[model samples]
Target: MAKFPLSDLRFYAVDTNVLIHDPNALFKFEEHRVVIPMVVLEELDKLKVGTTALAADARQAVRTLDSLLGAATPAEIMSGVAIIRAGGQALGTISILMPAQQSNLGLQPNSNDNLIINDLLVLKQSTEVADVVLVTKDINMRLKARGAGLSSEDYHNDQLISDMDSLATGYHHVVGSFWEQIEAIEPQRVSGDGYHQMNSATLQAILERKLYVNQFVYDDKEFVCRIYKEVGGLVTIELLNTALLMRQKAWGLAPRDLFQGMAMWLLFDPEIDLVALNGPAGSGKTILALACALEQTMESKDYRRIIATRSTRGLDEEIGFLPGTEAEKMQPWLGAFTDNLEALHAEDFDPGSSADYIGAKVPLQFKSLNFIRGRSFQQAFLIVDEAQNLTPHQIKTIVTRAGEGTKVVCLGNLAQIDTPYLSATSSGLTYMSERFKGFQHGGSISLQGVARSRLAAFAEAHL
Candidate 1:
C-alpha cells in the first residue's frame, strides 16, 4: 500500500489498450475513480470480434462493465456506476463519457484516442473529480494526454518487476569460509546419499531469503556447493556432485557451463514437472530442452511422444500461412529443432551413413498455439519453444494443459522476443521463471555463456 493519504483520491480515465491488455484493470486502482470514454467502448466492440487474446480480453472487459452496471438505473449509470468487487465491496465509482456530455474542449474528436483525452479535459473543468489522469498502455496516448496538460500514467498492476536482474537466478552465491560454517555445525546424516541435516532456523538465518526446495547454492571459493531440500522445518543439504553430470550425456549434448549443468539436472529430475530455460540466443536453450525431451521420451521411455510448439511470429517476417498439413506449415518455424537434431546426429551417430542419422530423428508432433486450447497432454514431453513471445495468459493456458505424466519445458531467449508490447520484465518466459521459482514441483534456470560458436558469441557480445 502507498503511504499517501486515502482521502486524496484521483480519477483515472482509462484507454482501450489498458483494458484490452488486462481485463481486470478496472478494479486495479484502489479507492480511485475510473472513467471510461464511449469511444473506448466503441473500440472494444470492434476488437471483440476475433478469436485472438485481445478479442477475449475485450469481451471479458465488456462483461465486467455490464455486471458493474447491472443494478444501477440509467440515470445512475450516466452519472456514475458503483464498481463492486466479488464480495460486493465497492472500491470506487465508474462513469462513462456520455455523448450529450461531450464538449469540444479545445480538441478535435478526429481520433478515438484524442477523444478519450478530451473526455478527461472536459471532466477536469466540469466535475469536481481531482486529477483526471489518462491511464493507457499506448505510449502515444499517454504522450498526447500529457501534451494536452493532463496527467497520464501507464497501467502497471500486471508488471511484477521493472528489471530482469531483480528475478532470482536460482543459484545463490555463498561467500567467505562457507565450508568452515558448515564444518562447525554437527549435521546428522540423513541417508546413505551424503545429505546433511541442519536446523531450519539456522539455514534461514544464514541464507536470509527463503530457499526453494532444489535451489542450488554455490560458492566460487573452491566451488563449495549444496542443493536445498526442506521438510517440516527441517532442512537438508546435499553436496552437489557434478561427477554424475560429467559421466552422463543427454542425446549426445553435454552441459557447456555451470548454469547449463544445473538446467540439465532439473530437466532430468522426474520429481519436477515444469522447467523454464532462459538465455540469450546461442546459449543452447532450445537444444538442451530438445535433448532432454528426447532422452526422456525415446531413450528412457518416460513419456509417449514429444510435442513441440512455438509462436508463429518470427524476428524478421512471420510464417504467415503455408500449404499442406500442420507439420509442413510448422516446418519453417521448427528450424531450431531440425538444426539441433542434425547437430546431434553428426555428433552422436555414424558419419558414414545417412540412414542412421535419419533413423535417429526422434518422434515429434508439431502443435500450433492457437489450437492448443481445450486440449490435454498426457504422458507426453511438451516443449514450448520461443516462449518469451507468449503473454502471461498464454503461458498459463499452456501450463494448465499438462495432464498426468506430462512434463512441460518452456524455452526462450528474453532478448529475442519478437512479439510487440512485450519487454524483458513482461515476457511470459520471465514471468513463468519468477513465479515458479520456489515451488517444490517446478524449477527455472537462466543459462549463461553462449555455446554455439566463437563467431556467434562474438556477435552476441558486440551486436
Candidate 2:
C-alpha cells in the first residue's frame, strides 16, 4: 500500500486511462494543481472522436475542462480550479509548461506511451518551480517516470473494497440447520439469514451428497444448518456438466483452478440469462469461457453462434485514427479470444486440420461491445470479456440485448484491473451476483486459484 502526501503535491500529470476510468477525475482532485500531459490530452482527443464508451467519456472530460477554464493565463485561479493547456486546450489560470525541442526525449513514432514519457520528461525539465508527480494506470509508465527522476503512482479510483474478507462477509454466514430437519418445511420459507450463513461450497456439498437434512456437523461442538438438495436442477446441471467437461479437457487441473471448473461453473447456468466472472490476471476466466463455449458448440447445437466481444478501454495512448474495417480495428482487443481458441483447438481438436474444424464447428463471431447495441440475440451463447471495464449502464445495455434463449457470460479479473469508478464490489459482476441471488435458475461463483502454472499461481498469490 503506497501512501501519498496529498497536501504536498503542486503539479500532477494525469494519464489518459485515468481520465477514461473516471471522466470526473478533474473534479475529484479539485484542490490539487492538475496537469493533463500534452500527450494525454492528445490521446483523449483521439478517443473523443470515436463511438466507444471510452471515447464518450473522453468527450465529456474535454467539455468539463473547457467549461472550467475559458481562456485564462498562467497561475490565474477561478472558482478554486487552475487550468493549463499544453497539447491543445487554450484556457485556464494554470501554468502551461511547453518544453523546448531539445527536451523531446526522442520517443518512438506512433507510441502514445513513449510520448507520455517524453511529455513527463518535458514537464520535469520545464517545471523547476513546482513539485510534480506522474499519475497513470500503466505500471511500465510509472517505472519510466521513476527512472526519469519523477514521482509516479497508480490511479486509485477503482478500489472500492479494501478488505476482501470484509466484502465476502456481507453475504456469507454460518447457522444451525434446524429448519432442514423439520418435516414439511417449504423451500421458499427458508430465510436469507440461513442461506447467507454458509459458504457456497459447503451448501453445495450438502445438496450434492444427499446427507441427512438435519444432521449436526460438529465444528466447535455447535450444530450448523444443513441445506442440501439431492436432485440437481436445470441450472445446476448445466454448471456441473460444463465444469466436468472443462476439467476433463484441460489437463493438470486442481480444486482451486481459476479457469477450470469454477470458471465453467460461473459461466454456464441455464437459469442465468446473464453471468459475470471477475478475477485478477492469470485467472483463466477467458480461457475457461472459451473452452466451455467450444465444447457446447462442437458437442451440441445448444446455440446458433458463439459471439465473443469486449470494450476497448483505450489502454494504448496513441492519437492516430484507426484504419481499415471493423475487423481490423477490433483485431487488437480480440487477440485474447483468438489466443484462447487456438489453445483449445491445439489441445483438444486435431492439429493438422484444426483451422478447418474451427471454421466449421466453432463458428466463433467476434465484435466490439459498441456494435452490440440494437441487436437481439436468440439461441446464442454470448461471452463478454473484460466486463470489469464497463459501467453499470453499459452492462445494462449488454444484458438487455439478450433475446429469448440467449445465455450471456461475462468474464474479467477484478483484482487484475479495470476502468476507474468500477471496483470489484461495485462492478457489474458484483451487481449481478447480488441482484440474481436465490433465483433457482441463476448461480454465481468466484474463482480463486491460478490454473495456468505453478509460477502463475505463486505470482497471483504473492505478487
Winning candidate number (TM-score): 1
Let me know the TM-score candidate 1 reaches against the reference structure. Answer: 0.88
1-463, model 2: which lDDT tens digit per residue?
A: 1122334446777787777656666655544677765666677777797655556668877886676655654444322245434465433223333433444364553577666666656655554465777777677778777876678887665444444542321112223342352222323233333332323334444344322221112212133322222334311111122234334542222334323444454344454466556566766777777766766666666677888887555632232356766666667778888776666557554754775767666677876676676689888889887777665446776888889888888777667444544566556555555455444444444556676789988988887
RMSD of 1: 4.3
List the RMSD of every prediction in angstroms.
4.3, 10.8
lDDT of 1 at 257: 74
True-structure lDDT of candidate 2: 0.57
**Regions more than 4 Å wrong, model 2:** 1-50, 54-163, 166-266, 315-323, 348-352
Candidate 1 residues lying further than 4 Å off, grouped into runs, are 1-7, 99-110, 184-191, 204-208, 221-228, 312-320, 348-361
TM-score for each predicted model, relative to the true structure: 0.88, 0.52
Worst 10 residues of 2 by lDDT: 233-242
Task: Give the alpha carbon lDDT tens digit for every residue of 171-198 in model 1.
Answer: 7766755565555554444466667777
lDDT of every predicted structure (CA atoms): 0.76, 0.57
For candidate 2, what is the total of clashing residue pairs?
10
